[model samples]
Target: MNNSLLIKYGLAGVGLDIVSSADICKHVFHTKASTKRMHTKNDNNNTEYSAVQSEPWSCTERCFPKLICCTYIHKTIANAFHPFIFIPGDGGSQVEAKINKTNSVHYICAKTSTDFFNIWLNLELLVPVVIDCWIDNIKLRYDNVTRRTSNTEGVETRIPGFGSTEPVEWLDPSHASTGAYFTDIGRLLYFTDIVNALVKLGHVRNQTLKGAPFDFRKAPNENQDYFVKLKQLVEETYESNGKTSVILLAHSMGGPMSQYFLNLQKQNWKDKYIKCLVTLSGAWGGSVKAVKVFAIGDDLGSYMLNGKVMKLEQITNPSLAWLMPSRNYWKMDEVLVQTDTKNYTLSNIEDYFMDVEYPNGWEMYQDTLPHSLNLTAPGVEVHCIYGTNVSTVEQVFYKAGSFYENPTLINGDGDGTVNRRSLEGCKTWSSKQKQKVYDLALPKVDHMGILKNVNVLEYISNLVNGL
Candidate 1:
């Protein structure tokens, strides 16, 4: 085999993992470094191809020359053998569909359809929706409140819907349903920049099947078709590329989903399919925001004025709750919360969401938040990257004696969304294994910014080279 084809790369992205616009690729790829292309002699002719070279490993001739040489050879061979697979986080992959006046759904895959610039370029149109969502949420809170004469018992305060505001207005002018058109910013821009960088580095290849990105809205295990198709794609990549093992890049919710997928595989699958698992801002432990949304809802429009007005309601979405900090990994019960008149603690905050008993055994699955702790794939090298430094709200307070109304926030350090402690979810796996699990907490990096951060990309590139 030629030196150029030595290593293969597979990249997975975060939630709503939709294919990005070519323009984004073009813009981001050129912003930093260009793709490294080299000429190689093929059987028939000279061809220009992608190439990647690992940084050199040095040895002093005076001491341990043989040892150094062996290490160098092993490192080069290792670098050339593995491919990367990036599993996008929640909302990273999504399908763009359009509905006609007659109600038939048509999927669109054009350049304009994937382009976020067109959708968000008009700040005027977008900003108002955000403001409206924020105002609507505030009103939702006030409207839902049931005033008390003396904080009477047995009277529950009404909970306002909060969290993510769905941009129903942003949908394709033709489609009226929420899921009918994929309108999430996360899916459009999440992996495009990283993909461009990886492709530019060369030697890395995307082995994904067309139109097969996992649906961020659905539970990971529920997507049997996606997983089955992914297995076929993996086999195809390996068969076509001399049986290269995969380096999985899982971000945000993708981290847990990757674990879920790996856990389901045969015990020996890691040896044949995986090389290293690197997670960027993995939400292994669920986020506090998800719990807040589950318990009382949130107005995300107030925080993010990006053209979409999203008021996350106090509703149950098992997938969102799955992002909550794992009970096995965190002492969530010990965490303290306060109210204007009373102080309370959460023994198991996740209990707030799973209160309703489902008819089937499905309640069993949702009730157990940390089932992932047992799903670790043995022998897989693990590396974790997460953002920190932003003030994170670790707990929420309510009006004294009010169970679900008048919530207040307390702060700690984290990305704007996931807190530092939750981002450190990978550490929960340390006690369970002897293998070294690595992590890096970057200052001033927000959850979304990690994607565009040049330093992060370089770090990942180095890791890929080392592999």
Candidate 2:
């Protein structure tokens, strides 16, 4: 086999010197060999070498070429525990795109490509001039007749490793060089810490722990296939783990998505398959942030980036419309956006969209509004964990000439991303359902910080261990 192929298989680091000659002989010649560690010293440089006893196994020349020995790495068998399914929020999953476009928006943009490349979290595409290309490639197109969205013409996209944690834990499998430099900026950008914590707590990845990352650009209404697969995955995981119920761990929009999934299932199915639902920084009732996202776009908390650059793509996503401020939480007269001549509230959202010159946004918003309007109880035990005490955008103000440009933000109590009312909306489930609802509000923890916060991690560990 080629050395580069071995490296790609993650075996290049394994030293052949560690395998004993006796083990290789036993595998090759079918001779019974006694396992023993051998120590030797090279005559030229007087270099000492120690060889570990390797397990005898079948080997072929095509498999290892010159190497005839292989080592078996032992793995610990975890005890029975509640399986976990991590559902990521919007833009939390890694998305790979293949370009097959017949037309190009820019001369530099590729019209066709043979390989799929990471479109999201690949910072290389997020740079100044290239970001436009990335936006065009990742943007979705809504069909008025279907009332559903599809990828930009000629671009095919897929979420990799649907039933594994690796894709969600490290969005860009390559971890692009930029991510290394900005790793400390946001923990929610990746779930590495959370996955590591679960692994340390005796949860084996892919067996006891899995991930459900979908096309975050679309809302749950358009995710029927995803829901079907998620149901099968949950049942398969439960049966594989000695019929142990699963803990649905969700973050941000995943919280609502999980709830929607649960609502679709039968009560007995939830009672049997679901251990409990644990949501971190759940946007239960939507957020005022979505209003701003519609008004003038958002950098998604990145201050250095221009929000307008991504507005075209962000506005096209139906999921963002589903995350708009819900009437169930926001009052009718309460203003979410204020301009020189008019103030916009939840009741006047269509007018807000009309004034912004994106009437199509109102269509998308109306299509997705009914899905999250009721916020029905999922009929499962719930643990809602969220952050508070940080200032979040509650409202936006625009000057006369600057309707879609620079806007002033009015801050309110939240987790720096979601409003407090929305974060605490899960509390409404307490009296609505038979299952017990536990709400945890951690002070001074921002939205992404909740993922890696020491206290939050400890709490999750304790909860999983106890279950």
Candidate 3:
């Protein structure tokens, strides 16, 4: 192989060069096994070898020309995504496997037929009626306190969990669907762009772009069946690619779920299965906004489509309750953000939701979260990326004790939904374990926007390539 290779050596004579064993290993194990974390200390006690290195492949010229150019690039590009798994944010994945009006349970209820008719009329007919009313020069009075006017013209309709305005044409082949709008576009919107970007960088193969979809409506541990499926996917990917450790990229609530799943595994699973975790706007401590939703159900969102108003009403979800700021994490002085002059903690507001009727008792559900310690896997290296620009309400209040009363909102810097303090929870480690935590704060980016942020994507690509 060496004799056939072109050589440019000083003309002392035709000389032979020997390639080191490490060089061969570097090319052969272009997978993460070569980049596995290793630590060594010098006499000066300067510890070395971080979890992430410069790049997984170092193109050195110590080998044959054919081996250097063809073999390395081909193997590295083909096996890139075998070591990566993407975890999506809340409502990031398609929740409904199949939608049948006859078999599906009704999520809405009314006291009387007349009430139902009126509700449907208001929701379905009001938008076009209002538009017509405006065009016909009819004066309509709506109290801003109770009701407000909305005009949706030239605005693209948005589906829940889907970031695109375009209609969905494709659906996941694994699941059959009956709903007209139930398409795979919602699921694709979550991580497909990031996956595609990685694919362009030659760090992710199209076929290996796998999604670990779960019921975000339920708590992480509560959905053991889905976690089992996630585990299977991880194992399959690992075994398929020569036991390469996987790099988990999770966003929003997916981050906590990934943490819970990782915590369930044996301590040594990190060494064998996981390379490191990269979280984007992770709800580590939970969000104060969720508390407001429970205390006073929100309007959710509304849209006008086909001369109809589609309004989504807020409802209590157990998984959302799970995302509520935990006591341990909320009470941390470093992360306890202040709104106006008063400092708000989960303890100060737990009473508001205590009396609120949840599907199950609030106390029973409260028992699910850790009481003393924050929910995080031990010894796993976590790199946190979050947005901090919009003014997030740190606490909600009313003139009286009820949400119906004149309400007031206090705001601070955050990702519009989650505060910077909460997103940075992973960085609040003890001094001994501080080395395991890393973080980056992006300004003026919202929670949902972080998924599409170029900087965030670039950072993730670097992490994947470096790992």
Candidate 4:
């Protein structure tokens, strides 16, 4: 697409240059030498304490070379506050890809590697022709025998700043393309508002506050390494904070991933290390939107973009399969996808995949479905905060001979992305676990909007303060 077309599509003033992820990382993770000390009164205790603002803490060079895993921390006299770890949702983390493919899908695609560059949130790569290259590099390949997914051959991908908030806060650190132009249309700032709110509350980044941004392409089953790292981060954060329990703040797919992680641990481990679980717009049960994304492409709510172009890459992601409307939440008889010949429900999702001509989706679904099917409680205090009163996709209708073509979407109540049933699926945990489950329904808040919603932020602040 041309500059004019991009401008018309809400990607105003298209910049032709590609910014390297290394440059953005350096700029975002750079540390300053300035330090200042100020006295402040604690609101809760009415006691005066010295607060020192210094350079952010980072992992040792031995652990993460050439990468700044820094977290902003404010040194205070009292260190009794609860530390937090943020887990990001789908497409919420920045992914870097180094091209070394033996074969090329198109001449325009990158096949040789100079260095790693940001593939996700790199607007320059998402342009019409270049996106083909991106699709190839970002797509995953599933192994039927191993029942797992791997990156495209010769394409090495990694999540930058695994233990820091920088990757999840602003996807594009340069803030040039999508951040500068498409903010009104799509999400550029992921967990920025929440991080800022926590900072304001004197929760230090990387010290008292940290982020766990995993490779969102694969489901939890395929992300054992990430979960292991997450466990260490939580434990380390807890130990660093005087053995204080860590609070897990998760969003969307992160919620389910966190739940799975919690389920894997012993009750004693959870009781000793975890404070509570707070999920914002949690897909406690998966969303119906995934089914539609499988059938027809999702423009990510941007009408100007062609969703069909990215369909193949999206379908290859096992995480998308994991996000399909959960059998635990959706009734067997409830129709999720409608066709001229038949309607599909939770019981016949495999047929829906076969009809869509991507039978591999069934294998992926089977591999991931077990992770969330039980919906077991995390055995800790839970706070499920999600949006409501927004029209969400409930069912999709495909006309005769139009399975891959445009389909009609039937809307139902949700957060404009997840259905009400999925959002409320956390309610099931209330009765299953001994720990308290708190539910907060914010009206008129959309999925991404919940991250920056004033009410939601205020609620989080209060919750953190009270804790």
Candidate 5:
């Protein structure tokens, strides 16, 4: 980052106030500030190939899973917004990103580390040594990590659709007509104890959420095979009935993933089957969780011990293995640098994105991802479902997975993640749809609860039947 770039970005205006669970290597650098990279001499060339640092005892990276996972999801989902522009937020930290449920016009904004160039530039080659190091830290994924793990894995239990060496026979008789259950998201298959319990809900007013079958092993990148699989599923299902009748029920990250699929369809480049698309707690718009993560590193144990993570205890129960803790954009030595706090030890949590703001038109919807799909594909029964239950998470995080900000934006309704206005477009969208965003609100459901809530399911089922 050059001085001119720094001046242009105005990164110093923001504050770094939050948690961190960066990798052990990062933590060593943070706590000791004296740890050096440890590289071994190449046996053949007898030359030091590179620097591989030896980290001491730091456990932040080894444990914080949800933060890292969600971080990747944020990037994967944010990628869906690249076809449009994202405007910068009030703080200039995040360029608001949004997703349009109709036409699927996505808006995205990306700005790299604001502090690295200031401190890590080598000064001679005009090259960013520190930024390069930070890049090396996170660039691991785009460069080799994604490639390295495409086939090899050591997962404890593989979900149904995704690759898994271990056999999971939950569904004795697979729904040949409907296709496999969504075991990829939730380890439990549809035939297993969970989905059955949930289906029982439709019969006896029972409440059972078997969890998502789509396991986000790595947030499905637009170019990944998973995207192709999703597209294929949409096509097969839509054409299965010989037409688009079934609804696409997606939650959280799935919402954006599905949106990306539809966006591809809009370009006349996608060949996925589909019909109605429903988003539940869909992070069509970015989540406040990302903002909070960047502000605070994921030191959950520390936060839990200190009682700070309790702030989110309600919104995101037990911040699983998707949260990455590299959200801070500090200003150092005139360059803007973004470094993943990493685990307290030297472990690298997954979700690591660089600090380069790809001018891929990612600045239009600063807070919203892409919000044009509804207008693009008006034929699709585009419905937005949100949970209205407020938890300690939303009470502090501003927006968990619900929309609760800018009351003037939508009318003051939120699904713990999305606020009322954030659901669709401005006033015009509302006049056309009325309270269709909520249809009917579930008083006390949390973010995930919307997917499992009986009321929400009924609402979805009814909507599907109408379609």
Candidate 6:
């Protein structure tokens, strides 16, 4: 084991600098260890570790480096994503990974993800870990929303993780985005841009008639794909290094993805190499926006075009008066906005306004796991980080009953996409919840901002260490 590395992401500090350990092969991963909850009153302050019960994967002799990077949009921190980070290598934006040395941007997590774990080994740091660098895009890009639009000229496209005022940069785009190139520096801005975009939606979408930006709930299957790829990347890392396990740290939506991935591993990955998983502000249950939109919004559920699910209109019926926020509507002749740049000059809300339908895909998900709290289930030692900053985004985007009805007319808390309570879950605490943080659920923070905040690391370190 190594002296604990303190990761200072927000404050003035670089990532972990390791005194390289020896590369060890042929080790047994203990599956009997069980982790404790967040350092709160419920658990009475206890810290012990355990692994899952399954057939373990053996290491092939090789010096491999495990490097996996995720883009929620094009940025590092997302409101709904875990704040896993890395140092930009000489190549700038290209995702890079190494086996022996760690390249980090945050202090605590600066060490390789494997270093974050409390594994008992002599030489090199070898354990299972996951790094989630996905940034949340306020205007979500998913199945329900189309990435581009067909206009009078041709098809107008909405760039991923950008604003009308900035440059349009595209990624491999597992979610959305096409055409041109998205730079490495541009990707770093993914989380921040997403937070700002979603926050501004209350004004752009509701106040103006032209409607706001795009919003997608993200499909469970797509999320599953990203994790699978990440697992492969990490394995490649292990093969590049001698062999190591890692502690997984995922935030917000990543939490649910982590859950889904672990479930897959438990079922088919008994021989898969995964160390541990951690999550922050994940929506294990369906989001409140989904329920509210279906319950409150107009027959907006009818707007599910193609394979797309409607925005937040999650529910079926709603009372109109409650859904309407205020009578003060912004008086504007044409709600449409044309940017200074020719690239982004279209709006999805208007083009697809009349064409809408309910999402039957969501229906199947809801029916099966109305609130599957499996992420923190016992077989695996999962950690959770919850947020308290729902009020700000809520007040801006959603009113009291907005989720149920007139989402177009009212706005509420959350980062404009998910509600606070929904992310926290209906139940406050559970015996199964471990390595948790209720304090990060602050009043000032929004969904995306939490991803970049510096103070989050203290609790994260505690949770990781405790786990």
- Residue lDDT tens for model 5, 323-401: 2111211111211112233211102111222111221111211112223223233223356666564532221222333
RMSD of each: 14.3, 9.4, 15.3, 12.8, 27.4, 21.2
Model 4 over residues 126-238: C-alpha lDDT tens digits? Answer: 78888888888999998899888888889899899977888888787665545334432235888888887776565556677788999998998889999899999999888
Give TM per candidate: 0.60, 0.82, 0.61, 0.82, 0.38, 0.38
Misplaced by over 4 Å in model 2 are 1-79, 177-189
Note the Cα lDDT for every prediction shown: 0.50, 0.78, 0.52, 0.78, 0.30, 0.30
Model 1 spans with C-alpha error above 4 angstroms: 1-81, 97-187, 204-212, 295-316, 335-378, 400-406, 434-436
lDDT of 6 by residue, 214-311 (tens): 11223333234445555564455334333343445444444545555555655334234444454545554434343334333322112212112222
For model 1, residues 313-354, the per-residue Cα lDDT tens digits are: 223234554565555545745554555654434464434434
Q: Give the lDDT of residue 138 in candidate 2.
A: 94
User: Which sections of candidate 5 miss by over 4 Å?
Assistant: 1-224, 239-244, 266-273, 295-379, 392-440, 464-467
Residue 192 error, candidate 4, Å: 0.5
Candidate 6 vs. true structure, TM-score: 0.38
Rank list by TM-score: 4, 2, 3, 1, 5, 6
lDDT of 3 by residue, 73-133 (tens): 4444334443567776655654321111222112231112211111111222235434332
By TM-score, is 4 or 5 better? 4
- For residues 130-197, what per-residue lDDT tens digits would candidate 2 score against the true structure? 78788889998888888888888899998889999987787678754443344323622467677777
lDDT measured at residue 299 in model 5 versus the true structure, 0 to 100: 27
Question: In order, how many clashes per candidate?
Answer: 39, 0, 0, 1, 119, 78
Model 2 lDDT, full chain set: 0.78
